[model samples]
Target: MSAQLLERGALRYTPAGVPALDATLQHAASVVEDGRPRQISFEIKALGIGAITQALGALALGQEAEFSGFLGQTRNGRGLLFHITHLVAHPMPANAL
Candidate 1:
């Protein structure tokens, strides 16, 4: 799904030596639910592992992109974590940033 990059944390390594990155993402979309158009927006906590950690850390704040991943619990079993495995940058309008 496509979403805006909200925040990114510093890259850190796991105990097993794999790189890890954590960030927050915001998603907004208009869809037809039950034959009615509606707007939906929400925020999710995201994570990238290994080589993807570097790429994720490079994304600018408010940048929009399509992310493919699954949802899981946080490391400490708090809120959900979006475990992003792939990302494709979406070109935005000149003023969209």
Candidate 2:
């Protein structure tokens, strides 16, 4: 007799408010023995003080600005991992800061 199987999708969460820079700077890890489990980490880095200042200035002027990017990772089993980091930023309201 053949048995039927069911699969479930992954779950995710996004916290409200800005994340800490230090927390975002740390490396992350994951482990799995069954199925093809995947773990993803995300972070944002400001290119320079000028860029960040400009973004903040835009917010003060009642304009909105946004920056975004991605993070990549690969695993090969002998305790080694590879990753490509990325960052993004959005101007918050002057009062929000």
Candidate 3:
């Protein structure tokens, strides 16, 4: 799904030395839910690991893109988090919505 890149924390590493980054995403869109169209908005915690982590670290603030990933609980907390496996740079105007 497409979302705005909200923030990226400093790069971190796993014990295996895999690069990783934590961040947040803000998504707002009109979607069909239960039949009718509805506007939805929410925030989600996100993660980028390996080479993707460095890629995410270079993104400019407010950049938007579509990402492919899975969801899971935070490493040491409670909340849904998106584990980004791949991303495509879209660069849409931040205020276009």
Candidate 4:
């Protein structure tokens, strides 16, 4: 999904000492719902592990990018977190250049 980086927590390490990062991502898009045009927006908690953590950390807050990952429960098992496995930054629009 394409999302904006909303918040980024300090980088930390897992129990085994693997790098980890937690962030909040916001996604907004328009879609057809029941043949009707609809707009949707929401925020989700995300995690970046290992090498992905470094890349995710490099992104500035509010930056937009495409992210690919799987969903899983947070460590506390009380919330969901997106485990980012791949990330691709969107190119800047020509007008912005």
* CA error at residue 86 for candidate 1, angstroms: 0.3
| TM-score: model 4 vs. ground truth | 0.90
Show model 2 residue runs off by greater than 4 Å: 1-37, 42-45, 56-97
Q: Give me the displacement of residue 30 in model 1, in angstroms.
A: 0.2
Candidate 1 residue 32 Cα shift, in angstroms, is: 0.9
- CA lDDT of every candidate: 0.90, 0.28, 0.87, 0.92
Q: Which regions of candidate 1 fall more than 4 Å away from where they truly are?
A: none
- By lDDT, the better pick of 2 and 4 is 4
Query: What TM-score fits each model?
Result: 0.91, 0.19, 0.87, 0.90
Using lDDT as the measure, which candidate wins?
4
lDDT of 2 by residue, 11-87 (tens): 22226432212111222345464777666443322221223333322222223233333333323333322121222
Candidate 2: 10-residue stretch with minimal lDDT: 1-10
Candidate 3 residue spans exceeding 4 A from truth: 92-97
Supply candidate 3's per-residue lDDT for 96.
Answer: 57
Clashes of each: 0, 0, 0, 0
What is the full ranking by lDDT, best candidate first?
Answer: 4, 1, 3, 2
Candidate 3 lDDT over residue span 1-97, tens digit each: 8888999899999999999899998899998989999999988889999989877887776788888999998878777889999888786675754
* Off by more than 4 A, model 4: 91-97
